[model samples]
Target: MPEGLTDDGLAAMLVRGLRPTRVTLVEHDPRWADRFGARAAELRRVLGERARLVEHVGSTSVPGLAAKPIVDIVVGIDDPDDEQAYLPDLEAIGYDLRVRESQHRCLRAGDPDEPVNLHCYPPEHAETRKYLVFRDRLRSSPEDRERYESVKRDLAQREWRDVNFYAEAKGPVIREILARGGWTD
Candidate 1:
């Protein structure tokens, strides 16, 4: 993890267990989509192919749904621990390394003054692909999107000490849907 706290921890703490306001189920907004593209463009200009498959994923990536308004971007590379190879470049491009999840082989970046969550994951990791699959599935299927949105709403209204615990609470439903969608792997 980063010398201080990993980005995941920071995010959890930042929210102070604030559950997302609501789940959204809509088409992506061209404006936000363009912002993601611009951000990816900046990353590309700086890191070249180091950020192999930079993608906009998360609630903001989905259209028409009310969200927390934070853009979640995934930047994939061969290995995240090999920071020496990409850190300096990313730093130069205006992304500050906020959290490091060494155990998870992931890192998060963002602008200190501005605000965005950029999750870094190794392309070889299952978590990386799983996130993509889940996001894609939610975006394409209204039934699944509504299902997830409903879950978010139900959970958000409840109080929880740890935000992670709240997120973990959704595991069963996520697994159930993923499994039903033929994503048993």
Candidate 2:
């Protein structure tokens, strides 16, 4: 578990009994941007003004970086804990609420065929800041981008019970890159 996350919090993040697909990295696809745009539009349509900010994030958002082909999006809302305000609407639109933590709520859209990880957080959450800073840093710094891609490629070959585990394993490298990029939180 990452620092500052309590045992319960870490446990809450785990998708118990849900096995994830083996890690696979593919060359960056330009279609990812289009997909993110479409999804963001859908989210905006569904949430209306409640969707404060919808951003393309994660490796897919960084051009030329190999990723797992999942479109990772960050959706900022007024309050993450207020599920009643948005969860039902999101669920009606085919998003499955998955991980629920203090900082954010995770929802999965699509299925085995096509996957999208939608992360919901308060606009000022530290995790949200990290996502934006790390993504922007990689987008602007080729050296950091290549270093991250190298780590990801190496990690993709390792065994993982859940794909989330693969993401967790990359924590150290992510923190290293974020730190080098001058991200404090």
Candidate 3:
């Protein structure tokens, strides 16, 4: 949500208060990395230099971890507020706008069972860096990775109005891991 709001639809995009998102998890699939590579490459090819920080992120990016089957990717741009710079291209490639916030915009593709979450931000945005740091930390430390997965498994069993709530519930552990990984924000 950029400054000077107008559309209530955009405001509600982050919180629909509609149907609940199913909290599902599956065993780590080896092909996830391949999917990420293809998507990243396609983004780079389409967006050229504008796609600066294309990266595989989130739980699915971590190997040997059970996750929601969605390939989450973070793509850094010159300015997330400038939708004209990247939105059209993203939508052209089948990624629909999913979440829009003050300094970020997310797009998605595929169905609920198999989806790709594309998060966008400016090159130096804090959240962009955080995603990379958290992902790398999980990748290198099996202990931390196990801890994260265990929490996700437990939380997935509980009902939620949306996946957003489930994500919020993991905030404590996320901050803890960020601390251990030398990330402070």
**Rank order by lDDT, top first?**
2, 3, 1
- Tens-place lDDT per residue, model 3, 1-185, is 23233345434866333356668899999899998999988999999999888989999899899999999998988888889988999999899887877668888887766689998988788888888889989999999999999999999999876566788778889889988888987
lDDT of 1 by residue, 22-81 (tens): 432334455767777888888888878787888887777877544545577888877787
- What is the per-residue lDDT of model 2 for residues 1-185, given as tens digits with 9 covering 90 to 100? 25544345556676553464578899999999999999999999999998989999999999999999889999998898889999999999899877876658898898775689999998878888899999999999999999999999998888776666777778988999899878985
Better of 1 and 2 by lDDT: 2
Clashing pairs in 1: 7-99, 24-65, 25-65, 26-63, 27-63, 28-63
Error of 2 at 119 (Å): 0.2
Stretches > 4 Å off in candidate 2? 1-11, 15-21
Sort order, TM-score high to low: 2, 3, 1
